[model samples]
Target: MIQLYYAPGNANLAPHMLLEELGVPHELILVDRDNHVHRGAAYRKLNPNGLIPVLIDGDLVLYETAAICLHLADTHPEAGLVPPLGSAERAHCYKWLMHLTNTVQAEMITYFYPERMVDDAAAGAQVKAHAEARLAQMFDLIDAELAGGGPYLLGAQFSVVDPYLFMLARWSRMMVRPARNRPALGQYLERMAARPAVVRAFAAEGIAAPFC
Candidate 1:
């Protein structure tokens, strides 16, 4: 069976939800992140970047959350977590997934770990504040897109991008202007949170309510 290395509420969330959505037999391996196990040599062998998520399938060891999501979607095409390849919908799916991981997730990293980007404690605070502001703009644009064409990012189809978006939005739950405050985006999150697959994933990870 497939095994997913994870820490609760970490980047592994999107893939975990996808696994549940796919109804595939999989094993969840806790990484003990709070004890810094992810930074250890063994974990580094699995993912040199020491990231929270790593997927092991047979002999393949995959890291990178977006890549894992795409792989799962591709391998389980019947589930339609992604659109048909070479189609416009598939292209759009790629677009949104890229935007979520490359753009939004990067900014979130800065917001949560500003010290990595700056020299002093004061500078870290400034970096975090600026990152939060940028995240707001990013989410605002997403909200506008949802306002025009949602129920899902691709409009009616529940794609891999939706779970990725939900995971990122949940990271902002403590912000002054959280992602849930936006009208369309807030509704989108509620819909995602209500999904049986999403609920199962959260429960398996021991994540409680106020999910977004």
Candidate 2:
């Protein structure tokens, strides 16, 4: 059986949601962040960065949230989590996935954990405010994409990208500029929250309702 080491609501949530979407049998190995289990030597051996998620499948050990989502989608193509390889839609998948992981999510990290970036406690508020402003613009770009063709990022069809997108959107639920504050993003997120996979993932991850 595949094993996914995870901490609830972390980047691991994306893969957790996808696994639910794929309807695969996998083990959830919770890495206790409160107790520093993820930071321990054993966990570090599994992931040098001491990340919350480390996917163990047969002989392959995968880290990185987007990489894991891609792997699960590729391994089970019948689930149709991604567009067909070499297709135009497939190219867009790659584009948005990279943008999510490298750009949007990176900005989210700064928004939530400004202490990591700023030295002074007072500066942390400024850092977080700046990140929230940047995220508003970034999410607005996504809303623009939706305005053209949406309900999902790929429009009509739900892709693996949605899980990562949903995860990031959920992160902003408590932000000063929460996703639900925007009309397009609010409707899009509500739809995602109602998905069976997302519902199941929330239950498994022990995340309570008002999931979006």
Candidate 3:
């Protein structure tokens, strides 16, 4: 059985969703952020970064949201969460996955924790403003991607990449202009919300519906 240590609505949401989609039996270990358990030595042993998510599958241990998502999808090819190996769609999956993590999610992290990016705490607000602007532009690109044709990111087929996208866009809820405010992204988000996978995951996470 796979076990995932997570805090509600954290970066772990992507993997949690994928796990539900895969219909694989899994255990959720709460890293109790409200009590700072994630920073505790036990959790740190699993992830030195003190991140909210740490996936443990027998002898294998993994952190980082995108890596976990890709692993789950690729390993469960029968679920069609990821495109076939060496195919054009597979290439597109990798491309968008990287961009979602390194670009969009990165900006949101910086946007939320600007003090980490600046020498002085006073500059944090400016850093946050700049990051939010970048996020707006990023969401615009995501909207464009959806507009470029299909219902899903990589055209007609839905992949694990969609949940990753949905989770990030969900984080955008606090933004001045969230992804749901964008036409294409709004419709896309609606579609994702309707999925049984999403419903189960959100319920498990204890997050109330009307999800972003």
Candidate 4:
């Protein structure tokens, strides 16, 4: 069985939701971030970086949300979390997955939790403003992508991309001005929030429903 060491209300929720969606049997091990449980010797032995969402599959251990999602999808093709390699759709999947991790996830982390990257408040604010502007632009791009669509990032079929987007969209609400003004984004958030897997993930963390 796969063992996932993670913290609720963090980026780890993305892969946790994916596992739930795939109906894959796994153990959810909650880590206490506030108390620095991840920094302890036991966890560092698993992941030197001491990050949450450390997936242990027998002798193999994985970190990083995007990597974990891709690994799980590839391992369990029937789950349909990702498109198979060489397929045209797979190209889009890889593209957006990278964008979500490097672009969307990067800016949000800088803006919402600047202390993680820097200590000076003035410097943090400047960095956060830059991130916020970039996030607004990205949200617009995502909105345009869905303008002609019904649901999901890549149109009809859902995949691993959904959970990543859902996690970022949830974080957007924490921004000074929420992205709710963007109609497509708002609709997409609604769709993802309605998913049973997403709901269960939030519940497991003892968090209130998405977007309050």
lDDT of each: 0.96, 0.91, 0.92, 0.85
Candidate 3 lDDT (Cα, 0 to 1)? 0.92
Q: Which stretches of candidate 2 lie over 4 Å from their true place?
A: none
lDDT (Cα, tens digit) per residue for candidate 1, span 1-212: 99999999999999999999999999999999879999999999999999889999999999999999999998998988888879999899989999999999999999999999977878999999999999999999999999999899999999989999999999999999999999999999999999999999999999999798
Candidate 3 residues 83-193, lDDT tens each? 888999899999999999999988998998999998999999999999999999999999999998769999998897899999999998988999999999999999999
After superposition, the stretches of candidate 1 with alpha carbons farther than 4 Å from their true spots are: none
Overlapping backbone residue pairs in candidate 2 total: 0
Candidate 3: minimum summed lDDT over ten consecutive residues — where?
74-83
- Model 3: which residue pairs collide? none
Error of 2 at 188 (Å): 1.2
* Model 2 global lDDT (CA atoms, 0 to 1): 0.91
Clashing pairs in 1: none
Instruction: Give the lDDT of residue 55 in candidate 4.
Output: 91
Candidate order (TM-score):
1, 3, 2, 4
TM-scores of all models? 0.98, 0.97, 0.98, 0.93
Q: Between candidates 2 and 3, name the one with more favorable lDDT.
A: 3
Worst lDDT run of 10 residues, candidate 1, spans: 77-86
Per lDDT, the best of the predicted structures is: 1
Which residue segments of model 3 deviate by more than 4 Å? none
lDDT string, candidate 4, 100-179, tens digits: 99999888878877766777766877788888888999988898898778488988899999888878877788676666
Q: What are the per-residue Cα lDDT tens digits for candidate 2 across 1-212?
A: 88999888899999998988888899999999999998899999999999879999999999998999999999999988899889999999999999999999999989989999967888999999999999989988888888789989988899989988889988988877787778888889999999998999889989998987
